[model samples]
Target: MALDVQRNWDVCMAENLERVTKESDQPKDKKDARETTRAEKPKIWKSEPVYLPDEIIIQILEYVSRFHESQYTLASCCLLSRQWYSAAVPMLYASPYLYGKNFDPFQAVMIPSRNLHVRDSPLASLVKILDLRGLVHQASRRITARLLGRTKGNLEAFIAPQASFGTNSFAALAKCHQLRILDLSLVSESPPLFELLKTVSRLDNLTTFRLPRSSGFSTDVNPALITWPRRLENLALSGGIDAHFMHGIVALPSTLRSLTIEHCPSAKGFALMHMLRAAVRPLAHLETLKLANLPRLSGSACDNVLFILPGLTRLSISVDYITPALFDFDVSSHREAIECHYPTLPHAESLPTRHQWTDGKQCELRTLELTNSGNPGVEDKVSPIDIVIALDEGALPNLRQVRVDKTLLWQASATAADVDALADALKEAAVQRGEDESTSTGVWTF
Candidate 1:
């Protein structure tokens, strides 16, 4: 009985017409009383079909195609006219989402009798995003490679299938000049590191790339650091990445903007710190830094590098890795070592709550996401309170928002006291900033 506007429009119109027909056949007594009925509504009629330009119509259908969940309505639009077919077909083919139920039929259309007939179809050229992540054991690897071969020219963002994407697809993937985002994070059996690097390095236009989980890969594999793709801006490495790859990384490309290192067990405290200073610090454009689930990272190693990041804007680090010293406004030992190199003031006391480098550029930090990443409350660690104390003291002057896992952090009694201290710090910080706490909304209670 539930009516969907997109799917049931014609049916609803027919039902309305039928009701009007039924009303005309009513008895004289009923007709006299019928003005009170809901069916007595007036209609706004137009004699000619509305003349919508092709461009406007296509634009309207494009929005419909993206906003609607089910494609039944889109498929119906294609049957309306040749003009509609041309407009809706491209939108439909732009991102063909295939799952277990439709996988076989889609496979047949893409590769009929093992021959790719994609070129014969206009719809195939419009394919841009082929998200095969949902496909698990639905088709063979050969079928996937065939589709990639057909769509390689125009494909932009491809998240490979979890199970079936393999070596055969590499040739087609490398040839995709328009390729930008390549995410193989869910790949079950990772291809050899040497081959993966060689294959991906050929993609000149690739921007956002995520390496496969290291667990599915061989530990013996040592991939030599080569010239990474010129356009790569974001890189995420996970799954117990081998130390050789981490240590071998001389420096990320200057174009690199964001770097994420998570669940990397081999890269310990000093190892990670060394990697950051050597490989990461060289990138002038690096803005976002995320380190999490790094168990072996000592608090001191994290303390050494974070403050010196030239362009860090968003930092999400595990609470376990960072220490209270990070919030300290004046530490003479570090000042003498680090400050002397910069042309700026030698004393930490001269550093602004909102930091500016010697170049006179304001620090870009806007959001800080401090998380435990599931480490239990422990002694000799920086908690939420320490951060509030720092903020109140005018550290991280441009800091606007902070995110932490409240549920996990508040489970134990020992940490609960720290939460109280955090509350006091936040209140005091708010007061120090001359904020009208009573009027300002969105303040979290616990």
Candidate 2:
């Protein structure tokens, strides 16, 4: 009986030993599985610190002066580093002018439906500027509505001609409260151009405005022409605009500093002179004035306008018909005109006389550019080169820098001897005036 009991105890001890070994192995297996998971974990790359500072990035962007060619590359720079992105995105989106082809992709995707609304979509926030050129087809109305719905409050500038902004486009644009600038230059077919302009009058932020050839709007409307933004400064007008329109424009915000009138044919020489007389009185803040490609501006009219706005620092006038005879200063017309119109103010003190034909006695005239008689006509008998020489020596006594367009120089029939004589005269004049004898004067010849 004692042997049988000892055998039973040995059997029980074996079973206990087996159970202990299984329990220990199970914990080891779990620990091994955990170790395998840790060893196989995936690695991720961390973002690197930006190498350049923000100011340096801005300076680099400023150095990239040619915007059109470099804009795409510069825009991509935004994705490269956060600093580069912040600096380039504003410039990239600042003056967004869209041509005709830019609307293709948008048009393809914007499947028109009576109930479609872009405002409900998540893609609405990406758009800031919309250029709807040659987009006035049947699909235009729907596309314009969608675009406006998406960007009504966000859009800052809209540059579309009259045709693109038919009734529907106009209605959509009317909702754009944040619009600051409008360029309506390419629309020649649409008659409701004035209506579009009238709609924009409600925009308190509308500042810079460009109008194409035709005063169809000005003729019909007599209201205050522009209720521009308080910050409105630059205005560019092309083709023929009426005198009344000019007056209304000048009456806009007094902050106007730059004004450009290009290819305005209806502005007769004398009529423009009178308009300048009336307009320059209030636009004393104007610093830069450019009148280019106007066919009717006579030399006398140009001179009269210049005398009226003597406070102008940068003046660009391209009147090919002007002659010295125009400067004959008829007592009845010019003397009283100059005295009455030219104001002697503190701003006039800094006016550079580099191109003004004045006796060098502490004169105030900064930069003067004049182009005359580049076209072949009976009127261009006097060589422009000789006139330039005479003006440099006599009229522009305080001359600092002069740029003569090559068109005038190429048309001049002066011989080599004449050219040499003119150069010598300029050298003598420079010496007498105690001015640096640098070739700051450029003669552009086409």
* Best model number under lDDT: 1
Q: What does the lDDT come to for candidate 1? A: 0.71
lDDT of 2 by residue, 282-398 (tens): 675787777776776664456565455555666666646455543232333455454444545234343434334222222223344555534455234334455456455464444
Q: Give candidate 1's error at residue 252 in angstroms.
A: 0.8
Residue 129 C-alpha lDDT in model 1: 90
Q: What is the lDDT of residue 47 in candidate 1?
A: 88
- Give the distance in Å from residue 52's predicted Cα in candidate 2 to where it truly belongs: 11
Q: Write the per-residue lDDT of candidate 1 for residues 205-273, one digit (tens) a residue.
A: 999988877533354654444568998999988776656666666667789988888876666775676
Cα-based lDDT at residue 305, candidate 2: 51
Q: Candidate 1: which stretches are off by over 4 Å?
A: 1-49, 68-70, 117-120, 215-224, 298-301, 329-363, 378-383, 409-446
Give the number of colliding residue pairs in candidate 1.
1
- Could you tell me which 10 consecutive residues in candidate 2 have the lowest summed lDDT? 357-366
Instruction: Please provide TM-scores, in order, for all candidate models, with all chains considered together.
Output: 0.74, 0.60
Q: Which candidate ranks first by TM-score, i.e. highest?
A: 1
